[model samples]
Target: MLARLSTDNRTAFMSGVRDYSPMLMAILSWGLVTGIAMSKSVLTVPQALGMSVLVYAGSSQLAVLPLMAAKLPIWTVLLTASMINVRFAIFSAGLAPHFSYLPFRRRLLLGYFNGDVVYLLFQKKAFATGYVPGKEAYFWGMALSAWAAWQVSSIAGILLASVFPDDWGLALAGTLALVPLIVSAVVGRSVLAAVSVAGLVALVAIDLPYRLALPLAVLAAIGAGSVVDVIADRADLRRIRTARPAAGTADPTGRTGRTGRADLGKES
Candidate 1:
């Protein structure tokens, strides 16, 4: 019986993996670019791998590379990386509900693997509608694929960087990878609008000191999203009110009374 149960669990995990193929592909593409960038940069293979394993943030890695190559002060590198990564605070807030139930150790492990694409995909597909036991395994599967691909690509790029000193224009590879990831993340009008606004703001403010423009763009996106979230929350309350009958003794709409399923879904 124990062996049978183990097989069942494996099957379920495999199902989740199959469900995430497209997302995994997009992640792989992004990982490739990140690897290429790391290889081309000044860092040695071991150092680049260490950053990938420890920091695991594409934007932050990219932002700090130029400064590191220039032999800038440690404070300058620290500030630049910090500004680039401040957006993760908001990402973590948005994802807290889905992950709050996890054990502390597991949560820390998940944090190590999570990235923008992984968070966004899990939000739209798995957590937004409702939680599913074992569904989080799919996220790790996706992350694992991307992580392996990135390491290989980076190593290859580093090896080839010396030979192809002709500048393969490898930096542009990141842009190519980001397009599909952006497409997969689009959920509703509010998110789409936020992306457009943020892109424009970032382009215009690219010259700002200390790379403050990136954070400013992030703030603008957050402000726009918060406004939308507030309006959506009000509408949700109105829905609940109308769904309840005059007496309010029970769930007239069957939503409040039935396992609280309606409330189980995320605010999105």
Candidate 2:
């Protein structure tokens, strides 16, 4: 039993690594930028290292740094970071069903490691195949690979910021890396609608202070996506309802009037 479990875990980890491998470059590029940004920020080395290790959120780290650099109020900085991480709340809810049988502590660990890409890949597979054994392995596989790559890249960037050239264009590299992911995610009508709405909202609200546009765009995208999904589901249900036979979908003899009747002459 133990051997079986061990093999399952190994396979799961490998699957996750294989699936997320293409994304390594993108994540590494982003992490490098984040690391450099933190190193160049007013934060001390220890402070930057602690935030990268402890916070583990590139966006949140970036969000509060400018505020810190400006000597802003503590409450404002906290709020800014909180808003940037609001998507995690949605992720937690979406992933709850997959790990509901596990203890709270285990679930918490999974939540801690879950990233946007992890959530996206897992969700796409889950919806397509429904529940399958060893899902936890897949989850950990993708999450851990991403976490490792991110930490390594960011730490290197932080440590090497002084030596790294500004002309290396890590930021642009990161953006370009995201193109494949963005295209992959835009697959179905509902997803396309959500992305379109979110992009539009972000562009329209780009002037908002404290990076408020991000959360606004997130909310708008959720609303748009939910609306699209609900409409699609209702349409599907309506089609099913219309196609189903009414009350007595049979002749008085208790045979189906349509398909059943056609077979009677041949049977006789």
Candidate 3:
């Protein structure tokens, strides 16, 4: 399938794959833990496998499983899952600018394949370079690889849940593996603020019923990040405003220093 792509696109695609390779272990462990949890829950083997295939959201699945097991109303389960997955809305918004030119069905498929690591890597690598060509291919490279790894590990865990003992600490290993990824993503003050707020909120609300803490943390993080972004933007605007007149004064050409000869001619 990749053979049909242009050389540049194929290169971009492979770049994405190589960048994402480091996170494969983390993704696999998390998926395996999720699968084991689902298998041991109220869900039958078929139901577990179906959720792993269709939902493809480990966090939401883990959060909603207890509610489902408790025979909660369908709406409650749906609502809880929706809340936990609300961050995907933010992810989609971030991704829209890059993929907006694609067909609606294609965009929808891309959105479906989007995940935390893929979005993070895409933003760091592709998005940072602006909307250049071959970004779609790059995204697909990471997304497809992540999807395949997740499904395989999850299926394996479900089929062999009984073989793996609970004391193996696979869950802790998965969580630990993500720590570095999280730390690496904290590139700015806004992100740091968001992560701090999210962690604090999650810890505070850990005892909340129905795993409400997860959504609460996500919301808190978004709010914190938005506020920080606004502040930073305003600061930048102020700096620009303050510098504009000085720059104009220094140039005396009203061209914002583009013509370096203005000041030289004036001094002469």
Candidate 4:
């Protein structure tokens, strides 16, 4: 009995680890970047460490840190963080369908750990397949790995920042770390289009005061992509209607293509 319990525990832990490898890599890179940035910035080592553990949102953290460095007001810092993270509301909505089947406790836990990469991966797979097995386990796996790596690396960065030369460009490491996740989230044309638009807008608006331009760029990109998608959807429906045979129309091959005949053949 003891042996069986031990085996079960090992299997569960191993499963979590196996599923978490990719997330771990991302978190490590992100942590290193955040650590280096924090140490180099005006924030002290303790504050940086605290932010790494408490915030857990990379983009938001990066944004808030700069504001802090600039000696921005607390209200501005909080508002900027909120705006940058508003996308999570959409993420939450997307996960609602899947969460419907889970218990309240599990759903709450999933909400806490559901970042862009993990949520996108799970969303893409969930839509492709009817459902995912071990989704909760996978969520926990990624979350635990990300959380642990982020904390450790950020702390390491604080400790090592002074030792490493300023030329090391630790922030670049975090940016590079984000590439895999961004690439993975690239799904259909609409999503690609939105990303492209966002990039252009951000570049153009980089000089905006108080980072207002950043959020504006994001909104602009989303708007542009959404307009294109709506147009495409309408065009597609028009094409579909034109191609569809009219009611009571007969096929060219002397076969009745009515609902009855179509049902008999089971081809449609």
lDDT of 1 by residue, 1-268 (tens): 2244455455645654565555554454455556667777888878877876677777788788888899999999999889988887877777678778788998778776666666666666655423656566666655565566565655555455465443555445546656776876767767877887888899999998668889989998878777877888999999999987655244555655444544665443
Worst 10 residues of 4 by lDDT: 1-10
lDDT of 3: 0.89
Q: Mind giving the per-residue lDDT tens digits that candidate 2 earns over 23-115?
A: 999999989999999999998888888888889988888889889999999999998898889999999999887778788999899988999
Candidate 1 clash pair list: none
Query: Which number leads on lDDT?
Result: 3
C-alpha RMSD (angstroms) for model 3: 4.2
- Model 4 spans with C-alpha error above 4 angstroms: 1-20, 101-108, 127-133, 248-268
> Which is superior by lDDT, 2 or 3?
3
lDDT of 2 at 84: 84
Tens-place lDDT digits, model 4, residues 1-268: 2244445454544566565576666677677777877888898778887887777787788788878888989999999888788778778888887667778897777777777766765565454222455554555655576677777887887788777676776667657766877887777778888888888888888876656666777688789789889989999999999998888776676666685587667965
Give me the runs in candidate 2 sitting further than 4 Å from their true place: 1-5, 127-132, 241-268
Where does candidate 3 stray beyond 4 Å? 126-131, 237-268
What does the lDDT read for residue 95 in candidate 3? 92
The predicted structure with the larger TM-score, 1 or 4, is 4
Estimated TM-score per prediction?
Answer: 0.74, 0.87, 0.87, 0.76
Identify the superior model by lDDT, candidate 1 or candidate 3: 3
1 versus 4: better lDDT goes to: 4
lDDT of 2 at 213: 86
- Whichever of 1 and 3 has more TM-score, that candidate is 3
